[model samples]
Target: MTDKTIRHIGAPASGRSTRERLNPARLLSWVSGYETLVLLGVLIVVFTLTSDRFLTADNLQNVALVQAVTATMTLAVLMPLIIGEFDLSVGYLIGFLVMLEAVVAQHTSNPGIIIAAGPVVGLLVGLVNGLLTVYFKISSFIATLGVGILLSGATQGISNGKVIFENIPSSVTTLASEDFLGLSLAVWLTLLLAVVLFYVLEHTPFGRFWYAIGGSERVAYLAGVRTNRMRMTAFAAAGLIVGFAANFALAQAGSANPGYGPELLLPAYAAAFLGVATYRPGYYNVLGALVAIILLAIGFNGLSLLGVPFWVQPIFNGSVLIIAVLVARQETRQVRTG
Candidate 1:
């Protein structure tokens, strides 16, 4: 495996032409590849000028905390996307898991067991998703959408259509209460997850294999990569990741509410797509996702400070997602044409 070579589908997405390196068009392409950063800067400047609160410490901390769960969910979305699969169930899945955690907390005084159940059950959910897509040959979108819907109902049923908040241990809440170096432990944990994933996806042989699979499943299979198994593993791993995030979320809120999952789903996807158009261009990378997450966080938080209506967030997210997909396509096309 070490001797094998796996080519990325978007290796040249960020590569600029040396012949006309300074040409306006070339420069634009390069800039567009990193437009998320530029957009983030613009949003920061605009919001700072527009609202005095934007630059304050309290507001900044709120921004980070608000996007913390989305940041974690973005990581969950990244893994399956790298393998060219979509897990639409993620938002619902994680939401359900959080509710489940609250239920566990209410039922037992054993903190460790309550916390431990999240990832374990999440892993099983991921496996089910894998089974649907791999063995059953269902479309990834359909399979995940169905799972998400099912979980939405399950979340309501198990929690009796009410919020869950009782006997959740202080340890669970520590993730939100504790902060080191000006960031919550949950935020630090999210960053750590991003870094670990960056390594696994960019440095490890497994990462290369994933790129190969994303590039072309048939080609990877012919090259001796266990494509199906890897795809399944990706979903399962994503679920496990989301499970941990759900726990952090449960810790932060110390409770769970129905309909919490769907709200983040669109934003997570938007951030993931924006990531595709960021640092690595057409490749879905953790670093890119982080930037995109910050970009979205700033944009959404800024808009809120402007006193916009609640409907604006979804509109903004939809618009960003559309723009991100277009940019990613352009990057991919540029490389393909070259």
Candidate 2:
């Protein structure tokens, strides 16, 4: 069989205009995923013109470091979205997982132990979510919202409304603080994870199955795709990613507070949603999420340097998410109608 990448190359551009025909799917694969490039360009122009500090290496590094945690969570949230499910619980789950990792490390002084157990807890939580949605026929949004509430409660209960800080060691701190090849460790990990996820979702049979399922689960099931298993596995994988993100945030903050995680959920989902509006246009993909997060990060970072209020970040994210989703929906509708 031809590789899944060729298949996901998607329908030919077939635009009515000559310009569109020049960049058909078969013609410009090398430059096809250039959404990131455009966003980067915007970043350059805006930062260079608006914020004096934005062009500095130190400011750039700070942006990368701060964005790393949100980018990680964005990728985690992308898993269920690919399968046409939304995971609202990721924010709340991160809170609990962050606290849980810190608490465990504090008691045991073993980062390895906490890291190992974090995903297991995430998996169990994901399983509960999947069971409720797939088996019990609950809407994914509602189910995940409920899970998020429960997770937040559990996190608060565990931390007793207090931040946990003293237990963090240098080892755990290195995960976020250390630089790899001059890039933040968190950003490096995000890049590596993106490549892995892209390969899995674009080149493998499972990747094709996810596309099929996302297109229409009933049809995919009829075509012999294991929709139930696929959904469950996707949710589980999302949970695992969220757990890792939780750890990254905890390490970065040098403290675990149940409040930190959910604040990021909006930007996380915004990045994922904005991703679908580019490159593949109507479909969600790994590179899209990465690019979207970078765009959002650059925009927010630049604004902050310009003395914009901190609350404006959410306004930007919320506005962008709505616009991105609307654009994606319109593209889908146009394709179907045309």
Candidate 3:
């Protein structure tokens, strides 16, 4: 093999006609990398054309507000995924924390303390999950699933198997109502989290270590990457993010429900997996996850505007998740076989 790398191995000479330059493999690769992005554009165009209200500023802001929590959870889950592990309890963690947040608010009107409760607990849960998976050698699926079930039961107990709407202070309840430039605080907070994570993952050695660890634990360990510690840190970071998500959820709804957070599990995971199809393609990424969240949110908003049945959401999310996995697999293959 030559030392030089071909720009596009499948492409013919540049001197060839423009038609020859438009090779199928190149096109497929491009499309695969930006699958969600392309779909997002298509959806926007379709919905804008079909529904008179779809492209309005008010409706778009509403979409942003509605998707803020899902975006946060999706971002939270991306940490464990980047390190080549799963945190099935991601959903339940949010559920438990939101209930906990409500309880905190109920007992104390201090906005600082009330908001702090969620992230603190979230960090602890992540630590416990890390202990089970990284230290005890338990499979992540089993460990996080166990934690998730425990959280589910705890949420039920905390809220008495129902949503908590009473004793929530006016300050706590109106947190999400604060807006800047027509967008809610929830939207701003989620975007802030995304930017921070993006920089950490893309511009720092810490991020490189994570990617190395994800590539191969054994290899990263042999290279003195402290695979176990980093893996635990990943889970912990994920928990911290979920904690913020809980706060956002509580702020937006002005009430805490036992099962509300858990319901977003499918869409959250869908965004996380679909993230692999864009931005940094062939691997899990923060930016990709954010984009995926917007795509899912817009898709849902468009469908709802078209008067689709409530049942269509699950099917739509499930199909996107499956497609995301397939696209990710193919992109990984391309990266490897190249």
Candidate 4:
């Protein structure tokens, strides 16, 4: 039979195939392509219906404010991930920078100086991490973990296990509390950074190089990408972004605690992994990360309103991470098999 004749086999005698029109598997495949977005919509609807305050403009603005730090850190995390590396130090690094900012504020009242110091320290730490991984040939996972431990120790030593509640300038607090156009400045800053990252990752050659390296270092190197420099740069960029995030954190909390940074690690990573299931599906992107942060913030906020215990947040976050990773992997498998 001709190809055209075979194609006609599924058609009904009246020129319509009922089976094809009602195929549940095909419907499922189409829906699965936008699973994250669908889930977000469903969550929003569920929360809105179950709680009186969930869909309020005020609550949403609050969610954006609360998630700003996580969104920023997720962006920072994405850089290293793009180059096939992990900066495990990001959690403690935040604590170390916050402590440094507080200590600096105590000695000096200059907001610019206080803010600049955090990024410098972060940059230095990131460079050190990159050097260890790239030049010394150490694994990024191990190197970053060791660096994180050292940072945690240094933070404790410097703070002496005391949270720095004093010497935080009014300007520092204002940075977090100040509102513009019905939202905090921190939220605007996060949005701005997200735009910048979107442009770089989606437009620039530098971003493409990182993806290439992540795909295959040897092949990327053969294709004339600077594998070592790009990897190191990715680490350095992550540090710089983390430093920026630390400032937002300080502004929000109005103080520094030695233990605060490590706690952020799980949530930040969870958001990052969950982000893979958003927007671009198989690849990590800043917009997706921001969406994931918002989704998480909403979920936690709803739970809090429902009187769920504080410990449940971490459990929820961990579970989301595992599910997101599995979904991302399945999407990847489908892409390969399809």
Candidate 5:
């Protein structure tokens, strides 16, 4: 038979063949995966139903501003995730960066470029993390967790257990307060970064290499991909983004506290993991992370408006992360087995 005839012959059996062929499996892989679309739909339905206040201009403005820090950090997390590594240091790293910026702004004569220092410090920290994980052959989780502990101690020692209330440079402040059109500066920055990250993850050679390595390090290495370098680079990139998030958050609060970083850790991680469950269900990607962040932010924000207690936020974040990850795992397993 001709190749074309063979292709037709291999098609699924008749009743609703077209629709069945487009079953959850095919659709999931193409549309990122079912998890992502389901999350998107859920967000839309919740917003539409719960509070007319949920989708209003002001509330959306709030959502963008509120989730900016988490979203930025989520992008940072995306790289390591794609390469199948996890960096628990992001939360503590942001905390340290925020505190460092505040302290530097107060003591240094050159507070003008102090915000820029955030990313520089991040790069350095990321280098340390990468080296430990890649060169020493330490597990990424162990290395990052150790680094996180060190950072927490360093931050506390530096501040002498005091909250940093220094008057940061005006430039930093503008990042939080300034508006671009109708959105806050942070929101605009988040959107810009998201676009850049999405392009890199979807279209760039580096992104393809990262994903390849993530799918199977051994296989990717056999195919001539530099697994170690890819993993290291992913961690470093995550650190830089975490630094940006730290600076943005510090400016938003106009103060730096040692505790700020850990507060964001759960939500940041939750968002990143949840992203893996959606769009691409079994895989991690930038757009999936962004969508996860948005959905979590909407649910949390909506609950807050409905007079939910302060402690409820953690409950919501934790529960959603666990559930999303579980669902993602199940779907992924079925895909692999069937």
Candidate 6:
């Protein structure tokens, strides 16, 4: 072949080399590393345009308040995810803890004791989950699922399928009504936890160890990382976070409802998985989870304002979870291939 024809055969007719067209930077730019953030921005803009109340201060505050519980749970789930484990019982744990708090509140007027019970129960649940999965050789998914079922039954038994409507301590009510800088205390607490968790997950050796374990438990073990301990710690941290979430839930509702906990499960997982596409792309991060929670809260609030049916919220959450999983898998594969 002629030299010109040979060159033509190697290069596109558009005068671009194959390598130039397939450049990683170009591909990544098109994919956008911050897909979740971009989606969130788009949703915000759309909602703002569609609903006059969407951007109002009251509405925004309400979104923050409503999402606080989910955000806390998302943080809990994120820890377990970092260590390559799932805590399916978080939603049920919230129910169990809230019921436990309410039952305690009925008997005691001291808010300190009532509040202190949350973390204790959370730690115990975490310990059980960790031992079951790490030591007993059960899969986290199945172990937590079984644990969650037990929690559900316990919650029903504690509350007797009745919502606690009275004897709620004043402190608990104050937590729900008290506002700081125009936001509810629960919202502020969620933000505070997010900040603390972000720092720990991104800047500490403990966090890195969990990430290492998540990436490859075998490799982490060979490298002298305490894989089992880290995994167990992740579960424990998750349980502790869930305990806090229960406290927030009780404060916000001023009552304990046996059925409310399971409703949070799908949304919490959705937020955590959706977060995988933000900030860190393939890895779970607190900032991403927080952003995801905000996005979901806004989306649901906007829809409700537009008179959408209640069932639609779960549909949206489930769809987001599926999409997030696909995006996370794609990102991970890209990282491996690259």
- Write one digit per residue (lDDT tens) for candidate 4, span 91-146: 99999999999989889999999989888999999999999999999999999999
lDDT of 3 at 303: 94
What tens digits encode model 1's per-residue C-alpha lDDT throughout 1-338? 22212123333435766665666765665476677787788889999999999999988888887567888899998888998999999999988999999998887878788888888889999999999999999999999999999999999999999987878889889888898888899988888888899889888988888888988999999999998899998999889988988988898888899867888787787788788877676888888899988887788889999999999987887787788768777777776676
Model 4 local distance difference test score: 0.83
- For each candidate in the order shown, give its overall lDDT on alpha carbons: 0.84, 0.80, 0.85, 0.83, 0.79, 0.83
Clashing pairs in 3: none
Model 2 lDDT tens row, 1-338: 11322113455556557766565654544344354456568667978898788898887787787777788888888889988998899989988998998889778887788776667888888888888889999999999999999989999998999999987877887888888877867778778888998889878998889888888999999999999999988888888888878777877888997686788787787788888866666678887788787778788888888888889877877776776667566655654575
For every candidate in turn, the CA RMSD to the true structure comes to: 4.5, 4.5, 3.3, 5.7, 5.1, 7.6
TM-score of 4: 0.90
Cα TM-score of candidate 6: 0.88
lDDT of 1 at 279: 67
TM-score winner between 2 and 4, please give it.
Answer: 4
lDDT (tens digit, per residue) of candidate 3 on 43-71: 89999999999999999988987778889
Give me the displacement of residue 266 in model 3, in angstroms: 2.0
What tens digits encode model 6's per-residue C-alpha lDDT throughout 235-336? Answer: 999999998898898898899988878888877888888888777767788877887887777778888888888999878767776787687667666655
Candidate 1 residue-pair clash tally: 0
lDDT of 5 by residue, 228-318 (tens): 8888888889889988897788778888887878777767767788887765566786777888888787777888877789999778777
Cα-based TM-score, every candidate: 0.88, 0.86, 0.91, 0.90, 0.85, 0.88
The per-candidate count of clashes, in order, stands at 0, 0, 0, 0, 7, 0
Number of the candidate with higher TM-score, 1 or 5: 1
Q: Candidate 6 local accuracy as lDDT?
A: 0.83
Pairs in clash, predicted candidate 2: none
